[model samples]
Target: MRLVLVRHGQTDANVRRELDSVPPGAPLNELGLAQADAAGERLATHPVTSVHASRATRAQQTAAPIAAAHGLDVTVHDGVHEVFVGDLEGRSDREAREHFDTVYAAWWTGDLDAHLPGGESAHDLRARYLPVVERITDGVHGDVVLVSHGAAIRLAAAALLGDTAETLYVPNTGLVVLVADPAAPSGWALDHWDSAVPVPGDVTAGGTPR
Candidate 1:
């Protein structure tokens, strides 16, 4: 099965460079709504059979349009939620940068046990996130969309595809596509990562690193 992991559209916290990783996360801003529409438009052409999203408001909102286009109701999964920021939730970028850098660097360096204060380690995240992907994709056919947060998507992509895969920052509304790999030990292969899709000007372009 092909799994398309999409980062939710821009949120107020994203524009303000603040962390918002908890239940019922912030809703989409205006540009974010437009981005969601554009994503829906693009995905409407794909052979997506199932639409999944995190319980977070932004993720659910992002999935709505796509589900509408496909006549499919979104399946909410807690495993796709953002990395738990814990004490850092809603904190300013300046205050959170050090913590973000430390933990994320460890994620890139293969230390899945590292995490922020009162937050989830990379290992903790993959434990929940990968299983959701595995369960959803198991015995499934055609394509599927999984709308989720930035950190969760990136970390899960790296974990599933292997350490050599790029762990780049996923722009708002970014797309990552993966497919089952029977030959690989990880059971997955990256078809694309942070793929750029045309959206409003505020949304940036990204994809697999060249």
Candidate 2:
């Protein structure tokens, strides 16, 4: 089975660059709703068999259209939630973001223990996220779609794909396609990656917490 890992739609926190990675967090903005629809439409031709989403409200909202299009209901998983921001929750400023970046970059340097003051370490997230993905993909025979946060998706992908995912960026509604691979370490290999890196002069551009 192939896994289509998607980042949830945009939120006001995403626009303001706030570190909002908590459960039942901000809902999608207007543009985000449209983006969600587009994502569903984008997969209309694919034979999607199952759909799953994180516990976050935005993730559920983002999963709705995709599930509806496939005549399936979204299964919510508690373990697939975003990396807990703990002490960094609700802060939106240059310092907080830079601090987040600094700590997250350490994870790329083989420091899975590095983390924000009270947030989850890279090791912590891999433990929580990947097993859930493996479980869902294992039982499904076709495509399994998962809607989750940017940071969580990238971190998990890094663990599965090794260095190829270290610098990967998955923006709102972006898709990371993974095909089952018995030869791969994590039993998955990258197929296609959809990156939403904003173009120059694009004001609609806002950073996601990838």
lDDT of each: 0.79, 0.81
Q: Write the per-residue lDDT of candidate 2 for residues 1-210, one digit (tens) a residue.
A: 899999988787777777887889988889889989999999878889999999899899999999999999999998888888777788876777777877777877788899777888889999999889878987678889999987788788878786555346677898998888889876778988877666422112323352
- Candidate 1: regions farther than 4 A off: 195-210
Predicted candidate 1 versus true structure: per-residue lDDT over 1-210, tens digit per residue: 899999888877666666778879788999899999999998998999999999899999999999999999999997878888777888755657567766777767778888778988888888899889888888999998999987788888888887667666677778889898899888788887764443433222221110
Clash totals for all candidate models? 0, 0
- Name the lDDT of candidate 1: 0.79
- Model 2 vs. true fold: TM: 0.92
Give the range where candidate 1 is weakest over 10 consecutive residues by summed lDDT.
Answer: 201-210
Worst 10 residues of 2 by lDDT: 199-208
